[model samples]
Target: MRNPSSTGAGRLLRATGHSWRGLVDTWRSEAAFRQELLLGAPLLVLVFALDLAPLSRALLLATLGFVLVVELLNTAIEAVVDRVGADWHALSGKAKDAGSAAVTVSLLVHVAVWICVL
Candidate 1:
């Protein structure tokens, strides 16, 4: 029989693979994901150009990471909503709106952090 640890490692690898595929799917389907990538890639390059303090650089990195993560979650929420139905039910609308709010909050945090740091 295979070792239990090996089996567990296989499961973990499979799960990671699924998540990576989902990220790519999200990127392809979601306009917001593309926008975030466009905005964030340049900002990340600018971050390196700025010659920032170590602490400031760390904060900027954190904010950029937050934007990426939140965008992913928003895309996931939207995908689930679309999968559920293209209908305009109230709960479905709320779920999409909440996902939008999450993106907004993340953006606000990014703005606040960068403004404070720079």
Candidate 2:
């Protein structure tokens, strides 16, 4: 018998809900997230429109997903930093800068993948 909080399906459902909430919040609050979505959405459709190998298509899609994941993580970092305090701190600045760098790296990877595949 699965414990109330330990069942695999139950945990998955809860996680899904949490993820949906995060996505909605990010979409509403983050202009960068919205812009990335706008850029990625059309490119994703174009990926489908082009004649590409299965592996190439999968890699292309995965790179786009990586960008979104990185952006979400960056947003989370910024939110936590802001929650901690409004005062300027070196550590806080480092955290936010690191998060931004991660997003930039992800975008670069996405571009590189697309260039290689096409």
Candidate 3:
């Protein structure tokens, strides 16, 4: 899948395309991703609309971004685990559980940060 021919703008374009495809696919397949996005959308507006300090705004933005990033990572982990097989494997369960726990921890941190800032 490595495109040696891609250089400069072509490379950027291809990378962007790959990212776009991932986002679209994640949106379609992951309910948590979609829900987090939808919930964050309004909070995004609130962050900009409020008269908060610069640092507070940044913290708010950072947490929201972090949540999405963690969610995406979790989804990727789940997909890889599922691809390996549907059989009952303890290691697979551990991997998936760990990924879910990561997402939960991220959301908890995000909530804590927002509570402090807002």
Candidate 4:
């Protein structure tokens, strides 16, 4: 068993490692995640390059991050669905669709934020 007193910083570091591993695994397995990172990366730099109010800049950045977060969640849902069974099922389909819709809504929000800011 681990020492309870050392849990604070140690736990945080371990959690960060797990999160990084998840990101790496997602990048490897999910093409959509890779594509979003590819596009979002340069777009993020461009966002900083633009002359805008501080709030607008922050909103734009937050929206971009939100899309990536949604995409990761969608990927996780799809993975879980696949793991449960490879066969087609109505509930599985519904879950996957809902996850996809979440990503779509996030993308729409990103676009809307950009439009409003620019």
lDDT of 3 by residue, 18-85 (tens): 99998999999999999999999999999999999999999999999999999999999999999999
In model 3, the clashing pairs are none
lDDT of 1 at 63: 90
Q: What tens-digit string does per-residue lDDT give for candidate 2 at 13-109?
A: 9999999999999999999999999999999999999999999999999999999999999999999999999999999999999999999999999
Clash pairs detected, candidate 2: none
> For each candidate, what is the lDDT?
0.88, 0.96, 0.93, 0.93
TM-score of each: 0.85, 0.94, 0.93, 0.93
- Residue-pair clash count for candidate 3: 0
Q: What is the lDDT of residue 68 in candidate 4?
A: 92
Stretches of model 1 off by over 4 angstroms after superposition: 1-8
User: Once superposed on the true structure, which residue ranges of model 3 sit more than 4 Å away at CA?
Assistant: 1-4
The RMSD (Cα, Å) of candidate 4 is 1.6
The candidate that achieves the highest lDDT relative to the unseen native structure: 2
lDDT against true structure, model 3: 0.93
Q: What is the Cα-based TM-score of model 4?
A: 0.93
lDDT measured at residue 90 in model 2 versus the true structure, 0 to 100: 100
Instruction: Candidate 1: count the clashes.
Output: 0
Error of 2 at 31 (Å): 0.6
